[model samples]
Target: MANIPVIAIVDDDEAVRTSLASLVRSIGYEASTYESGIDFLNRQSEDPSCMIVDVQMPVMTGDELQARLVEAGRRFPIIFMTAFPTDAVRQRVLAAGAHCCLSKPTGGDEIIRCLEEAMAGHAAQ
Candidate 1:
């Protein structure tokens, strides 16, 4: 059987993590949740097909995680979500190669679209 793609979700908010995980699973991808970027870095055993991350996480923000991954030569596609979306932050992450930065309470359809784009881009690379 082909390996099912895994989606990693990193958020400080437990409720957000739970909901995203359920959504990912409902869409037929495996979901793994991490409370913070540090938790994800410490526990991740394999590269996820894509990452859905929160920008304002306490221990390590989503942008920081992306930097670390880049510094380590990891190329996982990342999608960032934040309650306080800013032009500066969005531009920064996009410049740093993040797939996209989204606002919190984003619709499931938008997330699914971004995931599809990210996965397609990753596969092409």
Candidate 2:
């Protein structure tokens, strides 16, 4: 909620998570990486921030995680990413109130933009 936004990045791919964390940190935000959605849920940090999750994780998919978050009454904005992007998947994530559903090759600028948008929505509340 301050100047340095905290972003939770959940993905099964170690390389993807590492790269994302590095990129996110380079942009001056705090990034926490989790190997799986269940891992993140276990930590349960009450940090008010946004999330970047992979759609094809091993245990729980990004969409499934979003549903669980909703069931638990958690409203942090999410940006779902997938290598195999599809209209149906995008629509599903969007309908779950995600800020965006982006392809895996999304750049830092796009991620930053989504983060800013998500922060703005939180600010409004």
TM-score of 1: 0.97
lDDT of 1 by residue, 7-71 (tens): 99999999999999999999999999999989999999689999999999776889999999999
TM-score winner: 1
Measured on C-alpha atoms, candidate 1 has an lDDT of 0.94
Candidate 1 deviant stretches above 4 angstroms: none
Clashes of 2: 0
Instruction: Report the lDDT tens digits of candidate 2 across residue range 1-125.
Output: 46677889999999999999998889788999899989999996575488999999786898999999999999888989999999999999999899888897988899889888988888899
RMSD of 1: 0.9
